[model samples]
Target: MAKKAVCIMSGGMDSTLAAYMLRAQGYEIVAVHFNYDQRTQQKELESFRAITARLGTGQTYEIDLDFFAAIGASALTDRSIDVPTGGIEAGVPVTYVPFRNGIFLSIAAAIAEKEGASVIGIGVVEEDSSGYPDCREAYIEAMQRAVNLGTRDETQLTIAMPLVHLKKEQIVAEALAYDVPLELTWSCYSDEAAACGVCDSCRLRLKGFELAGIPDPIPYRVKNGVS
Candidate 1:
């Protein structure tokens, strides 16, 4: 039997590319997505389904955690705080979602344990990503250790962060090489109709594509000559 991997896909370029990388490595993908009532939850869910179909993976999970809205701390889940569109800031952005990756990984670990998967893949880019504390390599490694210690003795799962150290440009190049459906992915933190090109997520994605010398396949709402 082929090794099974639970890929924590967020319907974004990074996670989709990570899933494809695992598929290329001969692992049966069990794609997992979360709907935490974010601003672009519907759009993200749509992208997730489309990406999963393109991956041809039958095993998929869409878990909804409505607690994010109740918590209401981050800009993504809370409507009061505006998402930063000026530029990438120096420290952690308002859209960090307060230990979002850690929560997602814990849920992924549960899914992995239930599915008997040996690996849990998450696409967390440290270098070119929004400086979320949860996205750090050391934090993820610590979570992995904690997961193993908390799970059953027979269940040994490795958290695979294939894009941990990769730059956005490198990620874009690799995603194109793998023929990932970039058009089907969504990364905007605010707008759901069309990607707000000025937002941090959109800017980062666009910059990566620009640096890679490849045009982004997705449409963007031009803002201040950007897009």
Candidate 2:
């Protein structure tokens, strides 16, 4: 039987590409998208729906959590805090949502247990994460151990982070090689229909495409503004 893989799709470039990569590797994919009430939730969710439909090899599962907004200390979920400008070299930036990945991973693991998936795919990376403690390799490993121990005799959950050690450009290159639908993924943290190219996330995405020598197909208001 083909191994089952549950991909956590945030509708971002890395996660979307991870889905395609796993699908190409012959793992049966089941995408789980969590609506964490983030600022880009609507955009990401819509794009995820379309991209999964286009892939045609997996089922999309949506989980909603309004509670995330109430505990929102991060700029991604709360408009009150500003998204820190430039690279966050000092430490984990305010954009780091509290226990965000932990919550997501736990939920994903539970879903994997119920679905009997052998592997759980996450798109966390090193370069773009800056200093987010939860995005590091150590955190991933620890989480994996916890999940395995918690579900040992019942279900096997292998946390797979293919992009964990790769740079943004490397991820983009891999995505292009896999023919991922980049146009269907949303990276900007803004609410506009078209991506706001100035945010930290968008800027990093733009740079990644540039370094990867790939033309980003996503529509942007800056590149095609109303005249």
Candidate 3:
């Protein structure tokens, strides 16, 4: 039997590319996505569905995390906290959801344990990220250890972060090489209709495509953003 991997995807380029890499390695992908009542929830969910269909996804977990809205601090969930449009700041940006990746990984662990999967795939880029603390490789590794300790001894799991250390440009180029559907991914932290290109997430994505010498397939309100 092929090894099974429960992939925690965000319907973004990074997660989609990570799942594609797992698929290329012959893992039967059990796709997982979370709807956390963010500003772009519907758009992200739409993108997740499209990407899964293309991957021939085995089983999908469309988990709704509504509490994030109530515990809102980040701009994505809180209407009051405006998403930064100036540029990528020197410190942790306002878009960083509090322990968001940690929570997602925990839920993904439960799904992986229930599904009898051996691996849990996440797309967390550290080197080129917007300084989200939870996106750090060390934090993810610690989560993996904690997960193993909490699960049944027989139900061992490997937390796979294939893009943890990669730059956004490398990710963009790799996704192109794999022929991943870039158009189906959504990265905007604010707008649901057209991506606000000035947002940090959008800026990074645009920068990646530029560095990779490829035009991003997704529609952006303005292709030019803060460098």
> What local distance difference test score does each model get?
0.92, 0.83, 0.92
Give the C-alpha lDDT of model 1.
0.92
RMSD of each: 1.1, 2.3, 1.5
Per-residue CA lDDT of candidate 2, range 113-220, in tens? Answer: 877788889999876876788889899999999998888586868888888888888888898889888888898876548887766677778778888887889877
Q: lDDT score of model 3?
A: 0.92
Q: What TM-score does structure 3 among the candidates reach? A: 0.97
Model 3 pairs whose backbones collide: none
For model 2, give the 10-residue run with minimal summed lDDT: 218-227
* Model 1: residue 131 alpha-carbon error in angstroms: 1.1
Q: For model 3, how many clashes?
A: 0
Q: After superposition, how far is residue 132 of candidate 3 from its true place, in Å?
A: 0.4
TM-score of each: 0.97, 0.92, 0.97
